[model samples]
Target: MEEIKLEKGDFRKNIAVAGLGLIGGSCTKALRRTKTGKIFGIDIDSGVLDKAAGCGAIDDGAVDAQAILQKSDIVIIALYPRETIEFIKDNAGHFKPGTIITDTCGIKEPIIEAAIKYLPKNVEFVGGHPMAGNEFQGFDAASPELFFDTNYIITPHDRNSGEGIRVIERLAALIGCRRVTRVEARAHDRIMSLVSQLPHIVAVSFANLAVGEKDMSVFMGRSFMDVTRVSVLNRELWTQILEMNNSNIIDRIEDMIDILQKVKNALSEQDKNSLQILFDNAVKGKRMCLY
Candidate 1:
C-alpha cells in the first residue's frame, strides 16, 4: 500500500454529511477536531439536524440534501441502507466535479454497486466501514472518540481515483482510527458476515430463547448477561444488516448450527471424551483470535 500524504491544516475543503444519526454525527465531531473546514449536516428529520447543531457537531444544518451537497467539497453518506442509495441517485448532479464521497454503511457490496451505477461520473464514491460502534443508536449516543484505535476498512471500486482514496484515509486518521485496511467490496461483506453479522444473530437468538419463559429468570447468570449484551442493539439497524447480507448470513448460521448440533449430541450421550475435545478445540480457536 502506498503511504498517504497529508499535512496538518492542509485539508481545507468544506465537508457535508447527509445524515445526523450516530455515524454522521460522529463524523461531524471528528472533523471539528481537525479544524479543517466548515461542516454542514443534512437530514430528512429536522429534529436530528437541530440536535446535531445543539451538540456543536456541525456549523450549519438543513433538511435538503441537495442544498448541502452543493456547497460541500466532500460528502459523507451516512443514511440507512436503502436511503443511502436513493440519496446518491437523487443528488448526484448537485455535487461538484471531483468531489469525493464516502459512506459509513455496514454492508458494502450492494451499496458500492449501486453507487457505481448512480453516482455522477465526476464524483468518487469510496465505501468505508469503521469497525467500532456501541449498541446504542441516535445522535445522543455519538462520541468523538468512537473511531479511536479502531480498524477502518475502505473498499474502493475500479474507477476510484488514487487521490480519492487518500482523502478517505486522511478522514479516517482525523477520526483517530489508528489502523486502516483496503479490501474489495464483496470480500468485505463476506468477511463481515462471519465475524460481525453472525455474532449479532447469535446474541439476538440467545436473548429471544430466554424471553417469556416461566423458569427463565431462575436460570439467569452472569454468563448469559455477557453473551447477550449486544442483543440490546437497535432492532432497526440490525434488521437492515441481516436483510442486506441475507445470503452470506444464512450460510454462516447454517455452519454454526452444525457445530451446535455436535455439542448437543455429545452432551445428550454423556460422552466425556467428545465433550473434552469440544472444550479444548474451542479454547484453542478463541486464543487464536487474540492477535
Candidate 2:
C-alpha cells in the first residue's frame, strides 16, 4: 500500500461506474454535476446507456467494461453484492494497475473477500455503502441529489492504501454526502442488519398481510403507507442482500419478533400499563437512536 497523492484543487480522475441502476446512475449524475473527471457509464442495457448519455450524466456509455476498466483511475462497482463479486472475478485482469475500485454494495464481507481472492494485487478495493435511497429501482429513478446530506460509509481492509481511502472520501463529498464514516466491514454489516435490512423485512412482512384482504387500500392510512413504503422493493436484489447477510439479519429478525410478541401479549391480557410502558420505552429508544 504505497502513498499516492492527488494534486490539490484538481483531483479529477477518469471514473467508470459499472451498472446503471439507481445508485450507479445517481453516482454518474452527481459526478457529472460536480464536473469530476471523465465519467463512463456501463450497463447490460443499451437503452439505459442511451438514456444516461442523453441526460448528460455520463461522458460515454458502454455495455462492455473491459476498455473502461483499463482506462479508469477510479471504478465504482455499483451492483448487487454477488454480481459485484462476479464482476471483479470476471474482469480482474482488465483493471488498470494502481486503479482504485470501490463498490456500493449493501453487504461488505463477501465483496471484500472476493476482492482479496480475485482482484489483482496492484488494484485496490474500497467497500462503500451510501446511506441513502428510496423505494425505487433502475436508472429512471436516479437523481444527482440522491446523496445530498446523506452519510457514506467506507470499510477499508489491510489491502487498501491510504491514498485509495482518501480518494473515496473525496468522491463521497463531491457527490454531496454530508458525512463520511469509516467502519470495519463486519461491523458495518452488523449495523446495517439492524437499521436497514430488518426494516425492509418488517415492511415486507407487514405489507404481505394485505394479500388476502379485499379493499385493503380503503382501510390504509398514512401510517400504514409510511411503514410499507419499502415493501415495494426489488425482490431479486433484496433476496441476494438478505441471503448474503443472513446471520446478522436473522438475529435482528428474532429480536423484532420478541418485541412484537411482547406487544401482542400485553394487548391480549388487556394490560394497559404494560402497553403504555412499551410505548414509553419505544419513544425513548427513538429519541436516543434517531433524534
Candidate 3:
C-alpha cells in the first residue's frame, strides 16, 4: 500500500454515500444537519436517487459511483455484505488517493478482508456498524434522527490512518450516536451473529410455525408481533449475512432447540418444579435485558 500525502484541510472535503436505502438515507439525513460537505448518493435505481435528493438526504445523485467517488474525500458504502465486497473489488482502483471508505455492512470479516485486499494503497477502509434500524425499508422510511443515541461500533484495521478513523468517528457523532467504540472484526462478527443474526433466524422460524395455523390471528398480540416482526427479513442481505456467520448462528439455534426440548419434556411429564425452574430462569434472563 502506497502512502500518499493528503492536501491539508482536504480532510473531510466531501462525502459520497452509495446505496440510499434506510441506513444510507438516514445517514445522509443526519449528516445533512452537520457542516459536512456536499453529500452525493449512488444507487442502481434512478428513482431512489431522485427521491433521496428530493427529500434532502443527498445534495446530488448518480448511478456512476466512480464518477462521484473520485471527487469525494470520504465514501460510505451502505450496501449489503456481498455487494459491499464486490463494490470494493470492482472499483477500488478508481478511489482517489487518501480517500477513506467505510461501510454499514452488518457482518465485517468478509467485507473488510475483501476491501483490504483490493482497495488502493492510497485509500483506507474502516468498518462501521450503527446498531440501529427499523423493521421498515427504503428511503421513504428514513429518519434524520434514526441513529440518535444508538451504539456505533468501529473496527479499524492496522493499515488505517489516524485521520481516517477520526473522520469516521466524527461522522458517527454528527449522526447523533450516543456511544462510539471499537472491537476486533472477527469478534464483532461472532457477537453480532449471536445477538443480531440469530434473532432474525429465530423470528423467521417462529413465523413459519404459523404458516398453516388457522384462526390464530385472534390470539396474536403485541408479544407475537414484537417477536416475529423482524422475520420479514431482507431475503438477499440476511441470507448472505446469516450464511457468513453460520457457525455462530447455528450454535445459537442448536442451543435454542435444546431449551425448547427441555420445556416440552417437562410439560409432558407435568413436572411443576421443572416448569417453575424453566419459567424462573427465563424471567431472570429477560430481566437482564431491560433497557
Best by TM-score: 2
Model 1 — which ten-residue stretch has the worst lDDT?
1-10
Question: Against the true structure, what is each candidate's TM-score?
Answer: 0.92, 0.93, 0.89
How far out, in Å, is residue 291 in model 3? 7.1
Score candidate 2 by lDDT. Answer: 0.90
Sort by lDDT, best first.
Answer: 2, 1, 3
Candidate 1 C-alpha lDDT tens digits along 1-291:
555556967678899988877888888888888867889999888998888888788989899877777788889988888888888888878898888999888899888988999987888998999887877777888888888888889998998988888889988888888777899999899989998988888898998998777887688899887778798867777788889999999999999999999999999999899989999998998998665
lDDT of 2 by residue, 33-108 (tens): 7656689988999999999999999989889999778779999999988889999999999999999999998899
Q: Each prediction's Cα lDDT score?
A: 0.86, 0.90, 0.86
Residue-level lDDT of model 3, residues 183-277, one tens digit each, is 88988998897779878888998899999999879889998998898999888888899888888888888888899999999999988899999
Decide which is better by lDDT, 2 or 3. Answer: 2
Listed per model in order, the count of residue pairs whose N, CA or C atoms clash below 3 Å is 0, 0, 0
Off by over 4 Å in 2: 1-8
What is the lDDT, from 0 to 100, of the residue 22 in candidate 1?
81
Question: Residue 78 deviation, candidate 1, in Å?
Answer: 1.0
On the 0 to 100 scale, the lDDT of residue 255 in model 3 is: 85
